[model samples]
Target: MDYLLTEEQKMLKEMVAKFAKEEIAPVAREFEEKGIFPQEIVKKLGNLGLMGVAYPPEYNGAGMDNISYMIAIEEISRYCASTGVIVSAHSSLAVDPIYRFGTEEQKKKYLPALCSGERIGCFALTEPSSGSDAGSARTTAKLIGDKWVINGTKHFITNGEEAEVCVIFAHTDPSQKTKGISAFIVEKGTEGFRVGKHEKKLGINCTSTTELILEDCAIPKENILGDLNKGFKIAMVTLDGGRLGIASQALGIARAAIEDSIKFSKEREQFDQPICQFQAIQWMLANMNTEYEASWLLTYRGSLLKDKGLPYSKEAAMAKLKASETASFCADRAIQIHGGYGYTKEFDAERYLRDAKITEIYEGTNEIMRIVISAAMLK
Candidate 1:
């Protein structure tokens, strides 16, 4: 579907593809193996205007559209899922909320550094008790004089260890339940705010998944994001955009699995013939390609809807659900095609499977996605 892309988007796809193949592919395994963050690669990505590809130039962004952003993520993920998600979580979860719902002052204060990637950013909404039920979050924030003091622990936060800016959610009025939730921007070194336990993940180990502890963490009252007590709406809208990023990441992982399988099929032999010659192998390859294309088109549709300023929540949900599942499916099939070699670390098939599993779990689970889509239809 190259013909579907604008010239600018095509160029971005090419540029990102070239960069990922050259820079990320070689080092991805090494970084993941050592559980080391790809700091240098992330920094170079920032230099390339990829850190903020979909934002405006005034905020140090590349001023591209959502499709362009999707293309960049997909290309980057093709080589390294960890690197793809570093960009996605930063751009979609943290940056999109601030850019879309933030006050002019908040935008000016945060967007420049975040968009430039001089400072990494994270969104802290998930707690020990709250994942899909975001409204059930137990984090508390109290207004005292000119400041809001927050107290809670957020777990499973991506980019938490290295993030300089964090958009965190807390209950400003617990009596009001979901309506009580409010968003705030807290700096990394703010008093009583600290990073906590780093999780040992199954994959995407090169990226940090850690806990954020806020014990009476105080920030200016003005740090509240969007309107007071409307954090739920803000979160829903933000997650809608974030879903597209995850969808693109899933597409990348699926493509990687499919492409690697194709290459491996030609090289690996069975019964004195290349495995690619087998009918079963041919069917598996065909299924993988078909599923991948379907997911890609769904993601692209969601991106287009978002770019056009239309309601894309359902589309985003549909895209994320399908893409994430497709990633897992393709990776699993790729492993099957590789036979015994795929089960080993010597081949990337196992890693692809591990990495693809998380896509179905994060941003919003596939179960949640179906609910969103069905609700939209039933409504």
Candidate 2:
């Protein structure tokens, strides 16, 4: 299938690419090195209508298509994977559920601030006990009177600290397994709600990754997202879209690695010739370019399929699995091409390698993606 960007979409891509180069690229290493969150930068991005790229303008979104959103993500991730994921987790995971399944009241209440970037958002699903088996979540949401009292511990939560709005998943009834799970909308500073156990990670450290402790945190029954006892479906759908965002991120990182490799090969001479002239370096560059192109095609296909209102689980899985693997491959190759310099923090090659790893693991692991793909094929 041939996918093409409209004139407006091309303009959107160029705009984000320029912003990434001028804004994100300059401070990306600084923030990653210092482990400081770019609060001001995120606000700037939000002002540019990037935080709500694919949502309707009525909800304070840019009203762009999913392909345009993917393009924006790819450009930002090319400069900083950490910042890229911050936007992805917020937009694809948090804002998405509310927009897709929320009541009109919920949308009016939350989307404005979330889309404005004045209030960040997070998705709370993974717990200390659960990762892949979301149905086995130990966190519980009980109906007490007219309110839902949530009691659970969610770990590895992206944007946990910064988010004012959280879309959380919990088990309302354990007996029914996954079918008993439910989703809720919880605001920050609710009584008994607390952030805990902040982690320092190998990559994406600039993004807030914290544990959420919700003990008897009560929200009105109206806060229930989608329908009761159908959170599994919501989570799956959210993940299908999130995978496309992550796949775009992987493509961005791969592109960055390849571009860096090419620049370094031309400047660093070996045997009195620029390494770009060497067949070995040339072949590595060629392979990196090819991998990036292939991954882009898959990711764009998933994005296009999503915008077209098609069932895209298999396509999203394919894009995420290949693009994530290709990211790691390209980062590793870039490091090899840079030799010892790539091993140090003076250059971004090592950071690229680190950032590429988590793409294989999160938004559902590559292993999970493989299962999704295989199941569809077999069916």
Candidate 3:
């Protein structure tokens, strides 16, 4: 029932906030304008151990709790969502499943490098036709002698082009439908694996999202992530954690927009007085603040459930659903408050609005989140 953060958590938050303001905020606009990946900044984040905050120390992670992980994501995202997504995709979708399901050998081989950021990792669950319907993956993996040959195309894979490894899902038995899915570790530069094309996204441009083509790519049977035909379970379980990270990202965007809007309102003038004196502007700010707080509460609750090792699927979905919509709403208002400047690249509001829209679309769309939440309630 304790609402206050522990001393350690508070310190972690301060460290992340300091890093974001000093290191990330300044270059966010430049990266967005130039469409650069900011590899150097990503390496700096890796050095700070922010890349794997929630992972165990043995794997070169900070070994912090889920709340601390969420805090780090929020702070980084507040200044730069691209970096936030890079970290989130690495931690939640890529590393978490390995930590939770990989065999000891698999952990020994992959976890350290991934956790240390020596190599980036990506998760490939969404295919050209399968996004929310993860169970409907058409990617196929067939055992051929001592190796599994995989053939499929994955779309909208975050960190796809730059990652050294990918945790991929494929259908081992199409007849079994959802139960046929299996997870595999596919390294880059494999014989038949190739990066297709990078997507020119609407926002979070610094993080690479690309298409991956697996044309008879072969990997040893030992590369299977978990038991055969059990990937559907792993993918769904991994998404619960991923959704929390996305929720934190949404919270960060909203926080930045609200703070900036308030500051701008007090300084912006109309009729020889600050906009803060106007009722309409004040009401907009008030509503944004209220919604932002509510989103944080939801996100924090989901993180708490994760730390306690409790079932968090419903909470995670709820947090993602509310926080992402709240972020989009707040960003829109921030842009509105900025008047014409908000529509231009000179102000961060335009970027914030663009970035906020993606939060509602990825990590399972808000509509999908509602389905998850409602399904849990019905049960």
Candidate 4:
């Protein structure tokens, strides 16, 4: 229950909260309806040192901790889920890997641009054949003479269309199967790299989801990330951090729904009194608040354990699963509380519901989170 946040973390939360209110909230609806990625806002976030919240200043990062990063994501997501995902995917999936595993030369070459948002970054792991079974990926990379020649496709790649750099997984030794999988840093201008057609989705409409096409894409041998045949390990660890970010986003959705529901309940009258004054309405609000608080503790615990260099894979999964489901619950309850008004596009309640759904589906589905947790428990 004791958060005891450092001075820096408090400042970060306040700064991001203000920015979300003043900048993201005003345009969130228009952009979501238009299916437009908030590229300008993303750049502003980079300029504000949020694109790489926990990375070092030398790499153009804020040099903060995971808790600060989580708070930043939650606040931004409270306003715009699309933007929340953009920042999460860019920082947690893209930048963190390079910062964590890149060679000195590789870090020097990629980190500053990526961290500063001068060039956007994305991860390429999901494929047509392998979504949850990432180890079953069939993407191939042959080390030809000096360059690594890659041939395969990565589907459902967030930021794929706009990313300047990608942390891609491919099998260098197919005979080794999952063991052969290796991570690579592929630049956008590579000869055989291209973006597939964009996917129209149910929510998070403003973000891009496309296939990363690679046919004989050749890059320097030095581009190999981490050790050969260890990409699966790298990918798994990356997702652990990623789960925390998604959980925070889910928390944001729930928090936003609660704030809106309270505002509506006090103003919308029923039986000659406000809905909030009713016992049933009070129970709904109480349940939402209680679950939100519990989810926060789990989410913060995961981040705290991670920052302390302790084992937290199970904690991350638990937080992600609970928080994601909680988001959906709160969003649905918000609609129910609003009666007919919540169903329309004029209100953000429906948007929150739609946006909250994907939190369960991405960064490993809520189903996958359960699997991770059960496995951890059994082990």
**For every candidate, C-alpha RMSD to the true structure in Å:** 0.7, 1.2, 1.3, 1.0
Per-residue accuracy of model 1 over 273-319 as CA lDDT, tens digit each: 99999999999999999999999999999999999999999999999
The alpha-carbon deviation from the true structure for residue 195 of candidate 3, after best TM-score superposition, in angstroms, is 0.7
lDDT of 3 by residue, 1-379 (tens): 1246898999989988998999899999999878888788788888888878998889999989999999999999999988889989989999999999999999989998888888899999998888888888899999999999999999899999888879999999998878999999999989999999889988998888999999999998899999999999999999999999999999999988999898889988999999889999999999999998888999999999999999999999999999999999999999999888778887889888888999999989989999999999999
Candidate 3, residue 318: Cα displacement in angstroms equals 0.3
For residues 41-115, could you state the per-residue lDDT of candidate 2 as single tens digits? 899999999999999999999999999989989999999998899999999999999999999999999998888
lDDT (C-alpha) at residue 223 in model 2: 93
What are the lDDT scores of the predictions, listed in order?
0.95, 0.93, 0.91, 0.93
lDDT of 4 by residue, 271-335 (tens): 99999999999999999999999999999999999999999999999999999999999999999
Best by TM-score: 1
In candidate 1, where is summed lDDT lowest over 10 consecutive residues? 112-121
Any residue pairs clashing in model 2, and if so which? none
lDDT, model 1, position 98: 96
Candidate 3, residue 337: how far the Cα is off, in Å: 0.8
Return whichever of 1 and 3 wins on TM-score. Answer: 1
TM-score of each: 0.99, 0.98, 0.98, 0.98
